[model samples]
Every structure is written in C-alpha cells, then in structure tokens.
Target: EEASKIVTPNNQSQLEINGGTYATDSWTNVTPKILTHLGMNKHLQQDHPLSIIRQRIVNYFYAAYRNQRGNPLFSVYDKLNPVVTVQQNFDNLLIPSDHVSRQKSDCYYINEQHLLRAHTTAHQVELISGGLDNFLVVGEVYRRDEIDSTHYPVFHQADAVRLVTKDKLFERNPGLELFEETWTGSIANPKRILPSSKFMDQTKQPCHTLEAVKLMEHEMKHVLVGLTKDLFGPRIKYRWVDTYFPFTQPSWELEIYFKDNWLEVLGCGIMRHEILQHAGVHQSIGYAFGLGLERLAMILFDIPDIRLFWSNDSGFLSQFSEQDLQKLTKYKPISHYPQCTNDLSFWLPPDVEVNEGFSPNDFYDLVRSVAGDVVEQISLVDKFKHPKTGKSSVCFRIVYRHMERTMTQAEVNEIHKNIADASVEQFNVQIR
Candidate 1:
C-alpha cells in the first residue's frame, strides 16, 4: 500500500507515470497536475480539435506519399511514451551539455536522468535505429513556461522523418543525374531554388552529393508546402526563413501569414549524416520536420486561449467534432466569464545577480503550483532597479478566470494570496 501511494515527501516519493514508477529527487519538479495529464492523450480523442487537426495531416500524408503497392509510406506513432531519458531528449539529438534548454527551470525533470520530453524529436534517433524509414511521431511534450494565452506547459507536437536511398531518389526521374551540378528543371517554383550562400555550402555534407541534397530539400519543401496548402488552402501566404539547429544543417522555418500576423508554423531540415550514421542507417539520407499541433489548431479553430485546449468543459469539447475535420470552422465564443486581476511585486535576492538568480519561469511555476489552472495569464507589468542598493524589483499582473464558470473575487483572492506566499517561500523573494 505504501508503494502504491501517489506522492510522498520530497526525494521519498515514487511517482507512477505511465505504469512506470520513478523515484523523485531534488531535480523532480513535475507537478501532480502535469502527471495527471499524461494519459489524457487529447491528441487521440476523436472529437477533439487536436485530434481532428492530427487526422487531417495524417490523411494528407496518406494521400500524398504512397509506396509501390499504393500503401501509405509514412507510419504514424501517436502513443509513444512522454517520459524519456536525458540521453534520448538531449544527448542523442546532439544538444550541447551546457545548452540553456537542459536547465531544470526549463524542463520538468522526473529526476536527473529522466524527464517529460520537451519535444517529439526525442524519438527521432530511436525510430531510425529501429528500422523505420518514413514515420510520424505525435505526442504530448512538456515544458516549464510562462502563463499566457498562447503558451501552455503541456502541448502536442507532430514530428515526421522520411528517408530515401539514391536508387529510390532517381527511381521516378530516370533522366535525373545523381551528381547534377544544379537542380533547376525538376522544381516548379523558382523561389524554391537552393540559394548560393555560406549556409547552403555548410549543408552540402561530403557524404552526400549536391544532387542528393537538393533532391531531398526539394521533396521536403514540396511535401510541407502541400500540407500547408491542404490545411489553409492554396492562397495562404507563407514563406521560408533560414534557421539553425544542432541536429540539422541548413534548417528552415515555415511561417504563414494568418490573422494579419506572420506566424511560424514548422521547422525542418535535412538529417545530419552523423545522426543517421549513429542510428546505423548508412547510404540513406532524409529530412525531418516538427510542428506544434496547438498552434495550428488554435489558428484553424480561432481558440482564444491555449488553456481552453485542456478544458474538460462540455461547451468547449462539443464545439468540435471528427466529422468536421476538413472544415475550417471558427470556434464559437463560449460564455465570457469575468476576470479577476491581482498583482505581485518582489525584490530579487540581494546576494546574487539579477539575471543569474531569477527566472520568470520559476515564478510562473510557483504560481502554477499554488493556483493551478485557474490563472489564465501572467504578465510582467513593471520592473524597477534601486539606484542606491542595486536591487531589482519586479511586478507581475495575473489574470484569473475559470473556463467553465465565473470565478468569485473571494476565491481568486485566496488563491492569489497563496501564490504570493509561495513565491516568497520558494524563491526567497522579498514581498514588496
């Protein structure tokens, strides 16, 4: 009975996550609220907006890419475990040991060695090593982030990887040369041309011919562009911006103009040869891409807040359905609940530097620990530096509202007081 307990004192508790029990340590920061979300698998819920968007993408992949037998080429894995080891989450993906993302403040570590994966890319090398050539991994990812309308600690991501051999690359285009100097005639969009630049030069690994790299890049852009068009229609305004990642060379982020703003949709690039070599897959090169499902669903469904995605309210859930997967129906406004606002101000610990000692995310987590999901958004409203003592004081405004019903001012006040007290106790911040 003791072993089956859900939580105990710090470092004494055994957390049961997805049927596996892990001992907690100083690095354990995953909240019970976060743990409870593990099995929700909102992405798999048939009538959920997330599942509808996922299915739409899955359908596009099925119809767009097919093998010789007319079967879908990309296998989908949506049930991968959310918990992963440090090696799988960071080291295997070539993330630097000292990378800022490795900080406990940025990730929900179950312990030093295990954590809720921050991205679906954690399974990339594992799948490749397991002999999957073309695949998609969709799962919930966790992060310690700020409270806002668009950001949530738990969200879903879809990651896709497709590999092609030299023979398979030229199988359809028999006239195409493997070592062609430039790929111009095959691509329909001139804007898709690989520009001559330092970045482009770096992407041309010695292990792959220029023609091979160009072919892969072209195919990747084609598939992604087709996907965006399929989701947003052919008239959607979108562009490709050059970006960098530790695991991929010559990475690019796809941004779409939606709701009068340029919103980034996804990041993709050709797989680094070394990553493939590490996976024991030789003579095959591929491209990998990942996109946040909530970002897309929010835009498609006109969701006003990211927190609404997790709402179990029938009003929110009933607005979406599996039958309307292809329709871009705007989400109807549910009843508008009045918001209660509270402000918290505190001084940074005097002993440490402001930037080194304090992280907003830590304060955000502290508030979350005390208030849970009743708080909708937290914004830094003011910051002051005492000229004499060189001390920093910061103020944040928290907006509290319940999705299902109105939150009474008295109820919000109690939660707000608890959050303020917890902030002081946990962060050593002097209340101001």
Candidate 2:
C-alpha cells in the first residue's frame, strides 16, 4: 500500500514538498500555503520565541539527566522530515485504523500512503527501533483545524522518550529491587508519598510490576516537574490529571495555572510495553511525553495570537532571546490592527450526502486559500436546519486582520468575495 500512488485529477506529474517530489492522489489535501511552512524551522531560529523555549527545554534535560557515560542522556532531533508514511505516523504509534484523526478533515495527507505528521510522536517508534533509548523529537506538525487565537494549521511540538532497564533503574538505588512490595526509598523527594495500591493497579499495565511502574512514574514526573519549574520558575502552580493515549498506558496531562486559567501543557505516560517489544526492546520500560512548543512559549512570553509566532515582522522577532528566556520576559505587543469582520452564510447542497457534507474545516481551508493569514479567527455564528425543508444552513464570521499591518476594508472585501466564490464553485452552496 505504501508503494502505490495515484495521479491527481489535475494530471500533474508530481508535487514538490520539502525538496522532494511525490505523486498526488485524491487524498492529497496539503495546500501551497501549508507547504510554504515545511522548512521554515522557526524552532531553530535563535531569537524566535519557539526556538528559545525549545532550547530552554533541551538545556533542562541536559542538566537533569545523565547517561552511563556521564553525558547528556536525551539526544535531540529537531530537523526531522515532516513527511512520513502512514504506518510510521499511525500504525507504529498503535493508533486504530478507524481513528477519527485519520480522516482527511483532521490531517494533511500528502497522498494515500503518506502525510505531514500531526504530532512529533510520529517518530517515537522509529527512533526506538533504531536503538535510541533517550531522545527528544522536535519539529513542526500539521493539521486541519479551526481558526482562532490559539489554533493554527501548523505548529511545533516536542516529544521526549526515555527508557531504562532493571539494572539501570536500580543501579542508582542500590538497596532497592524491582519487585519489592513497597519501596519508597527510591523516591528522591522526602515529602512525597506513594499512591495507594488500588490506584497503582488502575494506572499501570498488567504486564508491569507495581514497584517498577512506581519507580518509572516517579522518575518521569520528577524530571517533568523540574522542567516546568526550570521554564516557569519554582513557584509555578501545576497539577497532573489522568489521561489516555493510544501509545501510552497510564497516561497523564500536566496543567499549569496561568493567567487565572488552568492550561494543559503536556501529555505523557509510561510507553506501552508492546510498543517497546515491537521495537525489539523486550527488557526495557520507559516513559514518553509530548508538548506543544507554542503552548509553552505563549505562557512564558505572553504571546496572544498563535499567528504572531509566524510573523516576519522585526518587532515580533526581536523581542525574544536565550537571555530573555531566563528572565521570563513577556512579549510586548507591537501594535493592534483594526479588524474587519465578514459573514459567509450558505445553505447545504440538496444532493450532498449527510456524511459527505461540507465541514467548517473545509470552509476554513477555503478562507485560508483565498486570504492566507490575513483572516484571524473564524466562528460559526449561526447554524440551523430549515423547518420542513430538511436543509441545513450555516453562517460563519471571519475576522480578517493582518499581524504586521492594518488590512484595508477594500482589500478585505476582495478577499472575502474570493472566499465566497471559491466556496460556491467548490461546494456548490447557495450563499445567503
């Protein structure tokens, strides 16, 4: 299946992406606007807020963990290819074939068999299979998502994985054993207490021993808590909430109190033993965590709009640095441009199947295709089914505002008209 390719209806011989060419199919939905972001690597730029946060986390791990050779334990891979096979991105991660994330509305598929990864976790199993025990994968991820202050089609993510065997795990705690009924001695924090056995059983995989799971969980939380402290300072308020992921057993999400609201910053848990076994590592237990770089950068730098991270304006780019990361400097707003609001209302095509009907994401993509980043936020202001007619209608409010400059009403009108025309031509909708 991976080797098969279908020519697009346009009859283009090949589509270029990140310096490589590939055959496109009906499944191909990657746009030129999205493709333009492929090699941007904003996370690598020295003065970019995303890059500053990435380096801060990298430095935290380097200082916190050490390998047997007395070197930094977590190897960093920040320049990995954004394109990956379906198997690598989904199957290897234990995601179900029928998962909603596999749909074209959720992911940016390059073809039937390949896609731009939606998360950095796409590389976790491959890295483990290649004999990397502890590593960080940092790169841009793509998705078809709603337009808002915090949501963007492309964003950066950091995924961290660490593996430890019985010998390595017990080596630092010489007196402790893996199967001991209750061993709290290994916990470095004297004030902390282990959870009840019932809780442990509920959180751990049956294949793992309680003692081993506790030790691994403790280490994972210790390192991650330290990371949060390192980035946000020792006084940051945070809590862990139980969560679920396809690739991780005993999953959790960490949320920090920021700006009077609890914001989830990362999701992590013990790596599924089956995943390790599949990677040819039978005797090791590990933990893996993935966090959005933009999420952290926004809190640390007070970045309001997600689009500003991609801004080319010197005012936005010049406000961050490695030094500023230590000081936890807030980003000063450059200028607020006046927003132009336009509403796009249309009725569903009568012949369209319910399951195949146009989605808000389809409309969002159309707006993006016509106006690019000039359109800031899109909201479904009204949606209703017509009485007796069995027809659906939707009204979308698109806020158009440029990050670096004010957009003229005339310019916005033209863009909005283009979006409306494109919607009618593409979805055969009657505009209201």
Candidate 3:
C-alpha cells in the first residue's frame, strides 16, 4: 500500500530520459530505501550492531561467512549448489510428469516454470557428478503446508551427500585415515578419491542386514555426534530411530534427547537411483540425508518455536550461548572407529496416528520426544505388503549408541521399551 502511494521521483527521473513522466516526489537516493527496510524489520534494528561502511563486528560476520564457505564441513557453502532459493527447480533430478509429488497438495507448482521445493534432496542431485564423491549442503527450503507446533510452510534443511560404492557404506575404509585436519582436528578425505569397490559389488548386498546397516548407520550418526561433541565439549544423550522419506530406500531419522524428552534432529538414507541419474552421477553408490534445520536450532538452543530462527529478534539471536558459539568454533579429535548398522522392520497399520489429535509425524515425534537418547538412528527399510496381517507394513532400521560408553543389549532394550510404549499408548501402533 505504501509503495504505490509513495511515488519515486528518483526512479521517475531515470525514466524521464526514456520518455516517462517525472513523479511529484521520490527519495532521490536509494540508500534510504535499504535503511528503511532494515529499520522496518520486526526487531532487527533493535540492539543490532550498527551498520556502517566498515566495522570490526561486520568484518567478523563477513569473515565468518567466507571461512564457513571455504570449509568443506560447511556443506551450505557447496560451490556446485551455489545456495539457491527453495522454490527454484533443481537443475537435473529427473521429474516424472505424472509423479504424485507434482500435485499441488504434495508440492507447490507456480505456473509452468516454478514450484516450492518439497525437499533438499536436490542438493544431493546438484552436487554429485560421476567423478566426485562426498559433500553436504545447508539452506532454507519452502513447502506449502499448514503451520502448527511442528509443521511450517518455510523451513531450513541440511542435505548431506556422499558418493561411494555401496560397499563403502558397510566396511571401514583404511584410507579414511587422511582426515586429520577436518573439523574434528582429524584428517578426513585428504583427497576426494573414493574406494572403487563401493558401487559394483559391495552395495548390492542389503544394508538391511544387522551387520551391514550398522556400519552405514554409524558413519551417518557420527556426522552429527561428532559435530555435537566438538561443540559441546563432552557427552550428550542421543539415538536414532526408523523414519520415513521418499528419497532414501533405507532411510533413518537421527534424534537427540533433550530436556527430559527425545527430539528428532536429522534424516538419513541411501540415495535412490533416479536421484543419482538426475545429478548425472553414474557408477557410484550414494548415501544421502536431509532434515529441517529449524528443528536442529531448536534442539541445540532449546528454542520452542520453529519460527524463532527467523524471528529477526536480536534478543532471540543474542540468546545463543557463548558455549554454543564455542561449540560452533571449537575443534575435536576425528573419530576413526568403524560404524555398525542394523535393520529391523515391524508390522504397522498405515492408519496409525501418534496421538489422539495429532498426525503421523506428530506421533513419530512424540516417540522421539520420549526415546531420542537411546536410538542413535532410524530408517525405513521396507514398506507396502504386510506378510502376516496383510495390512501395510512399514519397516524401520534402528541404530543405537552412547557417547559416554558403548551400549549393552539390556540397556538398549530398556530405551527401546520407552519408544515402544510411546508407539503403543499414544498411537496404538505396533512394532514387529
């Protein structure tokens, strides 16, 4: 409303040479417009560091952005990705015209040329070429959905992609030793070369086996745990549980138990072939994962609402602890241990809901709220036909670990019990 009423003389003056009328009034300078917007931001101007031509604080932020960009650990800065907006089309992932995801209910289609992104899976597609192996991306994503305690129309997502032969997801790579200087103060991938055995012979074997899935799950969980350990300076309760997503054939959700409840923090799975083809990748088995970034910020900082990250409130922004910043900047030893993965599936009704009034995601979330610490990771191993009940059976692979100590079966069972109970009592869902 204000834009139309406020005629721009400055813009009009430029247009006059092009034979346009000069407006009665206009802010002759453009700088004021930028300032006005900044000032108008809800609370951005409140207690924010002054914006000047040059300031040390400003320099630090700029430097941080660059340094974060330069670091491979900061996947958000991937050169192949170039940090695109959520609504833009991914360059090459194959899209079936009749695919259900194209529906307005599943994804936002803006005319013929644009759509709000349904997932950050595209980063996995954009970053991988047949020649390259591992990388990550962190950025905002958009969705058209009803907002609630957990759902949001706009959210942040972190996409992690690794190009390796399928076998690599299972066995220890001796060459992994080169990662001493990576964020863990340990070298990781001194070079980008991946083991040749992963694609052809190794990955074809099921990651569903107890032994196979465990190996991959460990590698997946370590990415998050290592990040937390380095930043937090010590042990923190965490776990993984079976979760669902479209991109990964065998996908898992990572969780962190906080404030006396389990909270979901991330997602993981092996990359689907169609996704690989879209990225122009051939001959490599890929492991990919993505999750809402706002959920992460909530878990890390204990902010209640998903909206707070974008709140533009200096107070909320200022609340991130010195410890949090230290965690962000601190270094830790690189983990060289091998990862173990395991898969387990149960007969579950497709109609199950987590709570009386909530949705499936909500129920799954409630389970996580209760059991996040015990489960190291979660993924869907199978879905569709239920052999016994003849109902839809969803499969999940469970990953478990403790940073302070390796887990014993009895201890793992106790944690699993809590999660199981949540499923039964809250959602009336059974786990096979």
**What tens-digit string does per-residue lDDT give for candidate 3 at 1-432?**
222222122334332211222232321221111112211322123321111101221222233323334643223332222222222343343333444555544443322333334566665554565344655454445444433445544455656676555444534544332112222322223233322312322222232333434455566566556654543346777776765444554566777767788877677776555456555654455567765655554444444444343445444445433332333321121222222344444445565322223333433343344543334455555666555656555555666654334566776666566656555554445667
Off by over 4 Å in 3: 1-101, 165-215, 228-235, 277-280, 321-324, 327-432
C-alpha TM-score for every candidate? 0.89, 0.90, 0.45
Give the count of colliding residue pairs in each prediction. 0, 0, 41
In model 2, which regions exceed 4 Å deviation?
A: 1-13, 172-201, 323-325, 353-356
Q: What would the per-residue lDDT of candidate 1 be over residues 1-432, giving only the tens digit for each residue?
A: 221122223446687888888988888988766777888999998689899999999999999999889999999999999999999998887776777889988999999899999999999999999999999999999999988889999999999999887789988777554333453323223234333334444555555677778889999999999999999889999999988776676688999999789999899998866678788887677899999999999988999999988888888888888876777678887888898899988888885444577878867776776777889999989888899988889999999988878988899988887777666666678888
Cα deviation at 232, candidate 2, in Å, is 0.9
Worst 10 residues of 2 by lDDT: 1-10
Per-model lDDT = 0.83, 0.83, 0.44
After aligning candidate 1 to the native by TM-score, how far in Å is the CA of 275 from where it should be? 0.6
Ordered by lDDT, highest first, the candidates read 2, 1, 3
- Superpose all Cα atoms of candidate 1 onto the true structure and report the RMSD in Å to 1 decimal: 6.2
Q: After superposition, how far is residue 95 of candidate 1 from its true place, in Å?
A: 1.6
Q: Show the lowest summed lDDT stretch of 10 residues, model 1.
A: 1-10
Q: Which lDDT tens digits does candidate 2 get at residues 163-248? A: 98889888866755444345232322323342332354346776677778888999999999999988888999999998778778
Candidate 2 global TM-score: 0.90
